[model samples]
Target: MNTQHEFKFLQYPRKNFVRNNWSNLNGRWRFLFDDEEVYTHPSQISQWPLEIEVPFAPECPASGIGDTGFHNRCWYQRTFQYSKNSKRVLLHFGAVDYQAKVWLNSHFLGSHEGGHTPFCFDITDILSESGEQILSVCADDDPLDLTKPRGKQDWQKDPHSIWYPRTTGIWQTVWFEEVSEIHIAKIRLAPQLERWEVGCEVFVEGPCFNGLQLKIKLSCEGKVLANDTYEVVHKEVHRRIALSDPGIDDYRNELLWSPEKPTLIQVHLELWKGETLLDSVYSYTALRSVAFSGDRFLLNGRPYYLRMVLDQGYWPETFLTPPNSEALRHDIELVKAAGFNGVRKHQKIEDPDFFYWADHLGLVVWEEMPSAYRFTHDSVERIVKEWAEVIDRDLGHPSIILWVPFNESWGVPDLAEKESHQHCVQALYHLTKTFDPTRPCIGNDGWESTATDLLGIHDYDDQPERLIKKYGSNHNIADILTRYRPGGRVLTVEGYPHGGQPIMITEFGGIAFVDRKGSDTWGYSAVQSSRELRNKYEKLMEAIHRIEIFCGFCYTQFTDTFQEANGLFRADRTPKFSLNSMARATRGAGYSRGELTSTPQPPPLPAPDTEI
Candidate 1:
């Protein structure tokens, strides 16, 4: 095996999977890069840095490196020692963007493609006791390649608009474990509200698990609600447990999960042959219902407008990782503070930590499948594998409500073939529904809106009246907007970038002032005064309120990024607007109350990065 890695500190289910002396391998490591070049052995590295963190890439600040140029290849190398009693050593990488090839101690294990999924290797067959083990990886990602599902990743050195710079190499946690032959590899939780049961499939690590015993326990808070024991005798194992009363009603009355409240219950599982326990894992879930009845979304059977923002989960400092859990918590909290019920996690399947926070914070999430740069038949397989991992891993969380597959055909090279593209979306839609029918599946966020469960619109105008002029009436524009079936909910996610409320001003109030004070930029820099900003925002809100035609409306942003200055808060998480006033405005109250006289800001802030 390569070596033993005991990251006990970062272990989840902290009570059971405690890692008391875990070390963070997130610093400098030697590196090299070349897409066409192949160096299977770490000893054969050429023209590269010596080390980088296993999870954070060289470009991100957290990785201890600056920025990697676009359209480049990257390689990383590291060494560690293996200890005794480590019968089976395994290497685990939380996530690696683009493509990666893994090697341990001069032995070739495997390679994985896709930037948003986690992969592992079993090093039991090849380990040297107390000897240095070598690790090598190579990654290739082109942020500008629209053929892939590159969400908002820009190819340029600097980012602008919605597109941000690409993250390469390892941008997640990496470690190793010493596990036994008979252990649980993964747990699949499928909650079926209709059957009042939760279906499960446990994947065992080694071969021949037929004699192994599987134990499961479900609970609310710390109190156990249901328990079951079974035997796994097949390559693929499945189990179902029906609850007497599947809902939780401890004074709270069957805890319902919504943006207003998020409740999660704990679940524990173990594997054993008889008296010997193999592996045990603790997880959590929330009892909730999300469905599409008739033409609207019903959360607990109530109509809800999914007010959401386009959250890419990228940061200027950490690349992908938040500065800390508190940072993650802060983002979700800020979204809620800005009057958004949910976020459309654009083009990235987030880490569990992000999801955990989202669930607890009561913010809804629209999870999307990250796409590759190029499209091939095998792309579907890769998408399926990564997406399956994402779905199963986050299934227990209650905040996720919708799943998006193809985004305006980013990774869909066959988009020219309407029938074929339609098939892809349809296939994914069916797959989504099959997994969790309790939730609605959005086939494509802004593809046609007709093919999906709800209609998503991206329109922009400098004037609110223009929106009414274009989509407000039964004219030619409305004919185009309403091309699809009539039942789907029509929503304007992005439209003409107006200054804010016209007759009044509402919508997103960014930290343009700070950007002007610090960076000088904006989503659209046409205003000249804070009063104009306030007016513009109020006018947009006024327009939204006046029409009442949108399911819900979301302004451009919540905070500042690298260069884009359209945030209500600085990039450092400090509030830009007077917190009290921003909150009051976000509370759905009318801003400006009536016609306001204010000069518009002329030299608008520059657009940061434009991501797809």
Candidate 2:
């Protein structure tokens, strides 16, 4: 195996399960748009007139075909060389929008739904005798379909208010790998911070055999932490490996993960049949915990205030797909440099590379589901299914602190009056908790929240005085929640009270400053000069810091997306003001000196009733 090639591919694609020998099929591919949906199979298409860059959708400029028109169907074809070997071949797709049907050498491999999750197919038996394989894909994404979780992709011919161009076909990496017949299929790591142990579940796939064993080794830096071996009788094995606990707080703090210090424990796994090593892979995880205690958000068992920015995860060249792996790391770096410890990924389920970078770089993330515009049985089923896949794919990442299933009642529009809509919100919340009981879940984020662990309000008042007057004290907060509506919507539904959940202003401060010329640009408020923008930002931060009710806050945005010029930086990621100035404003007076303390504890509130 080429060590350099392996290193290059392992850095970005699927950090959880990585092997030495694999192939990255991410270059040019034959592409064509089929609006009529006439061709059922790859053989029916006689010609491929367009050449598109893989992983980048056609609506973006990086795809080499920047056509943002309404095309529901598209086709892709490519060829690669592979020889029959003792190892089994697996073809993997990072993601494909809406629906996708794949074919290898004109033979149907499989089909996958949901645009945000990954799927793979075993192609070992379909390899051609000539050592060449032809791969084809058909992606069908209806533009006007309101039942699918479309995120911010606009359905109209032109981009509107908060929505941008539609991302049609493949928008993520496509690769292949070779594995042994009996290899480790999957693994889920659960870190027990209090017990000083890591719980691991390993899934094995292949023909049953005797004398199979699995070995796991964990380390940090150059120091070995734990090494254990388990006998594999069945397919899945679960065990908790204990780590030597340092009795001192300072020593244990060194091992814990936080925004100030990110320590990842490197993981290495080996599968053996008797003395023969069948497979080996490398991964990493961190020990971290996030929860709420008496109206305060706690990180690593201590109260921690979250200064987060809303990240849409979009680019000028690539709509949803990142231009490269380095870009993903760069975005996280920029967020941290601006003095934010976390980010609320707005709608889209971002690429795995983004999550990997955040995990490695010590940035907490709130993973939100893309919203479907309409409410229906099909919409509910689609969102629920896709949300499950999302949770499954991101369960192991320690950086993801919260799961948001619905945002501002996008799908359940009648959440206030209709019993079915109310049930939908409660169902998603409970379902998310069922899937991931470790982290908190927010049912409806912005407003009209029915069942949620956190009460998130969206207020773009624009005036610091008004913000202070509105949320200066607990009395004001109570009035706002009960009587006054923030964005013309009640904070919680009529039947649901506050319930003593920690409150946070999830959306605010969308100050637009048009540094460049663009007629389509808009924001909640406008500033004429950079100085004015900086001053306004400083005042807003000051007011938010003064608020006694908010446990944390997420600023409107991190970077300027298309037609939404409310970001701290321009669309190209150039800062409107100096980094130091922005950082100072973001971290108000005495923030670095640890003047901030936990919010006042409210009376013990009863747990929400399980029955809806």
For lDDT, the strongest prediction is 2
State the C-alpha lDDT per candidate: 0.61, 0.87
Weakest lDDT window of 10 consecutive positions for candidate 1: 603-612
Task: State residue 267's C-alpha deviation in candidate 2, in Å.
Answer: 0.9
TM-score (C-alpha, index-matched) for candidate 2: 0.96
Candidate 1, residues 1-612, lDDT tens digits: the string is 111322233333112222222334555678755555565466676567445654666777666666656645677877777664635666777777777778777777898877777788887777666666766666766555544445566766687665666788787777776666777777666566555666777777776845788887777654666888877877456987776663454543354566665655556777777777666666556666776555356776677765566675777777666666567777877776666677877678776667767776677888888765466766666776677777765665678887777665556544434465556666787887787666666665553432456555554345767555544544543454445321232322223111121110113333255425545465654565656656666565555545444555555566666666666666776765555455445445543422121111112111111110
Tens-digit lDDT string for candidate 2 (137-186): 99999999999999998988999888888999899999998889999999
Q: RMSD, each candidate, Å? A: 9.5, 6.9
Per-candidate TM vs. native? 0.81, 0.96
> Lowest-scoring 10 consecutive residues by lDDT in candidate 2?
603-612
Q: What is the lDDT of candidate 2?
A: 0.87
Candidate 1 yields a Cα-based lDDT of 0.61
